[model samples]
Target: MEVAVRVLPEGLEPIASIFEDLGTGGVLIEDPTLIARYKDEPGDTQVVSALISGQGDLPVVKGYLPVDERLPERLDNLKLLLDNLFLEQRPEISTSELPETNWATAWQAYYKPVAVGEKLVVKPSWEDYCSEDGRVVIELDPGMAFGSGTHATTTLCMQLLERHLKGGEVVIDVGTGSGILAAAAAKLGASKVMAVDNDPVAVRVARENMVLNNIQEVVKVFEGNLLQVVTGLADLIVANIIADVIINLTKDVPRVLVPGGKFIASGIIKDREKDVQRALKETGFTVLEVKREGEWAAIVSILGE
Candidate 1:
């Protein structure tokens, strides 16, 4: 069933709590800037209410449950919980028509080969991309998941990988969106590579890309958030997610690193670099280098002694 939630400005915190509590399919952030600025208490409680979409003449019911209950019951409680929260008033929503096609095929029209440093090139699977002068080619399809190596963050991360990754090292890619970084690690001769993402779709897509690259066995893909489900120490850990998630990850990334393990992070705006660096410092990582392209930045850090 499709469910749409309208959260007033003040209700955003509760909405975020609901997403975290219910493990919902996917969240479409209407106001990402506002959500990014929200501050949360350590033990904040949340309530979730599920209401049927496009159901006419049916009275909606809302229900409340503690965070530990099964997801189905939490979803069942949506209508009741929403009724109390909104007092039975439906929020106004606008819909519009746009040109549509199979996005996978449509995306191919705009996809082009991108050069990431002197040694590496990223090409779409539908295109025939040949590297001149013996450069490394990473063939990928930018499906519904993000990270196709065209973003400034991905390019910066790849440049860092080109420089720092030594053969036979263990590497971990946190938030491995399309398994791009993990595949690059395999190509660079990393002895072991593990890629993890919270989205199962992302994990599936990453696995498919790994197979396309003929490195499916070399790069293992796992479905989970951050580094929680990942085991073993890594010589290199690369995370290309938002600034806030990167900061949260820094608190635990060092623990999964060998003594001299290196950490590479991107997907941060230039303005947020200092804050992310501070968070990394608190987690025993010393910033070794910073690379900038346009409005984005990537940081390389080594575990502190």
Candidate 2:
């Protein structure tokens, strides 16, 4: 079965991330007002919908936002969050059952090849994408993890990676969803890459993607939180996790980076950029640059030699 989730525009990004993490095949976004509004204008209302199958996926799915009787309470809590923020009007949250079909092939239509930076292209495994000369392609089957290259946060990380990588650097990717960053690093000429995720499902999915991209020899996927399982120092570390997790990871990042190593951190809301920057600064990191896309921000920091 599938659950169709509807929330206002402001709530779409986070909610979509949540669904993606939950292992849903894909989330379809619909905004009816986009056509009428100007190109830069954002639609006020939007729907974020996802498909989940069987009793196995139901328990895990309901833990976040239930499709059962407790759904009203979930909706109420979400509205309360919006109310406390006082940014915009509260979003309307609703859910309904969707007809089941062959989800694998059905979802392929929703994802396409996305170009990141100057050299890298993120293509779904089912899509046939012929890269231009001098471009590197990373094929992915994100499944439930994140990093399909569509999210602004992921794109910002990829852009920073493209700009900073000088070939033959050792790289670590914390909270490496879909192993996209790890695979990209390997394809971009990183000598060694380590991809870490606490979730077992994500670890498996990431490993599969590494093989799909033909970077298995250079990139290794591990199941662990942040840098807990990481050993040797890396020349570059990239993370596309939430702002709060980035703050926590900052404490450990310095210990795992070589002198003059760089960090590319994203998945931050524009409002929380300072909070993340402050954490990095307190940990003796020099904030090199801050990049923004819409309401999201990515920060590049370096450890002193």
Candidate 3:
């Protein structure tokens, strides 16, 4: 059987995280307008589906959804939470039994190799791709940790990381979803990398990914919120989280960073760019660069002595 939720495009990332927490690693993303006839059509609705099965009389439900009367209640709670977070759209969730087939590999068709910045190439673990002479390839199975290296927020961060990294520096990746940035820093020749996330599952997936890339020795993954668990001083710190989180992190930026250290902060909506920039400046950071793609913005800053 398959459980599906039709959510707003803005909710795609968080919805996937919810599915991951449910232990369903794979999600099939369906866009109604991205077809042969409506290739250029713009649509707001996106469907995220997860596959499930029952072994016998006892049913298996993923994540926090139990196999009892509370299922509907839990789903309703989830919907309410999402509505509050997204604020602009309501999730229309639906469930249906699917015909027995290869549900595991079906979602793989939608994933492909994505090249970010000048040196980074993010390839799904199942996909095969040859790296160019100067490219660093990261094999990933994100497991719904909110990053696939294709999102504009992530791309902007990677681009900034590539440009700012000068090798042999200590790097800190806050809210390290899937540990993409940490692994990239390790591969880019950072002497040490710390990847931290509040989600335990994301931390686990990130550790696995680091091992998959054979960079585990250089990158360490931990489960924590923001910079609370971070130790030592970082020469470079990169955070690809939301604007509010970024604003809050500014309070401790000077404590965790070295003199003249670089801070790469992304995942800000364009409307909130000025707010975040102001916070960074107030917290003793000088804004260096501002890059925008679509409605997202990534800012790079330097800590002042």
Candidate 4:
């Protein structure tokens, strides 16, 4: 069964939990207003318009379930939970049946070689690409992890990384999702790179990606929260996490950075740019440049000696 639920922003977590409890493979929350940004063809405008009908900015959360004998009971349970959660303005959910699919790998069909920077190309492990321009490639198999180097958050960090990295500098990637940034650092000429993440799944996928890129010798993956497991001086540190986290991260960044070392912070929404800037400055950093793509921003700064 396929289901799509329209709910307010605050309701996403609860509704997603209900869907997961019903044995949904994955939950996809989407804002139709933002869908236009990812569409490339002229005909896609109509599709975007169709999605925007009457939805406004309300997110549409989608999930899928297998057809089984217990499906009716699961559906009842989901509806019951939804009603108990929202009494005043209950959200509407739609459902339909879908043919059996190997959806886990099917999403990879949309994954293609993307040029994130001037010389950097993010390619999937299952895809083939010939680099006629001698561009650097970071082969990846993200699996359950998030970083595929295509999202604006990841791309912005990659662009800034390309601009600042000099040959043979030690690099650290905090909140390293799928190990994409660590691989990028190695490809961009960083001598030794440390990729850290608290999630074991991310650590495993990132390690697999490093091996896929043949960068294992240079990039080491570690499971840890933020920068807690990181020590010593780093020439550059890149974090592609949220604004509040980045703001909190400012406290420890300066101490870990070498004098004149650079820090690239992304995963910041446009509204939180000023807050991140203020925090970085208060931590004794001089903001060098801020780059914005779509609704996201990446800030590059250096700590005072």
Question: lDDT per model, in order?
Answer: 0.77, 0.79, 0.81, 0.89
What does the lDDT read for residue 22 in candidate 4? Answer: 80
Give the candidate order by descending lDDT. Answer: 4, 3, 2, 1
Off by over 4 Å in 4: 1-76, 79-101
Residue-wise C-alpha lDDT for candidate 3, range 174-238, written one tens digit per residue: 99988888888888889999999999989999999999999988999988889999889999999
Question: What pairs collide in candidate 4?
Answer: none
Model 2 C-alpha lDDT per residue in residues 1-305, reported as the tens digit of each score:
34444545666666566556555545766554533244344533332111211212111122133356765665565456545544354444445554434543576688998888888888889888887666788899998787888999988988898889999999999999899888888887899999999999899999999888788999999998889999999999999999999999999998999979999999999999999999999998999999999999999999972
Q: Which lDDT tens digits does candidate 4 get at residues 260-303?
A: 89999999999999999999999999999999999999999998
TM-score leaderboard ranking: 4, 3, 2, 1
How well does candidate 1 match the true structure in TM-score terms? 0.68
Which of the two candidates, 2 or 3, achieves a greater TM-score against the reference? 3
Off by over 4 Å in 3: 1-69, 72-106
Backbone Cα, N, C clashes tallied per candidate: 9, 0, 1, 0
Name the regions of candidate 2 deviating beyond 4 angstroms: 1-105
lDDT of 4 at 31: 76
TM-score of 4: 0.73
Better of 3 and 4 by TM-score: 4
Global CA lDDT of candidate 2, please? 0.79
Candidate 1, residues 1-305, lDDT tens digits: the string is 22445544555455555555565544554443333233342322231111112323222122223333364575555545545555334532222323345434676787898888878888889888767778888888757778888889998999999999979999999999988898888887888899999998899999999988888878999998899998889999999998999999998997789987999999999999999999988888889999999999999999975
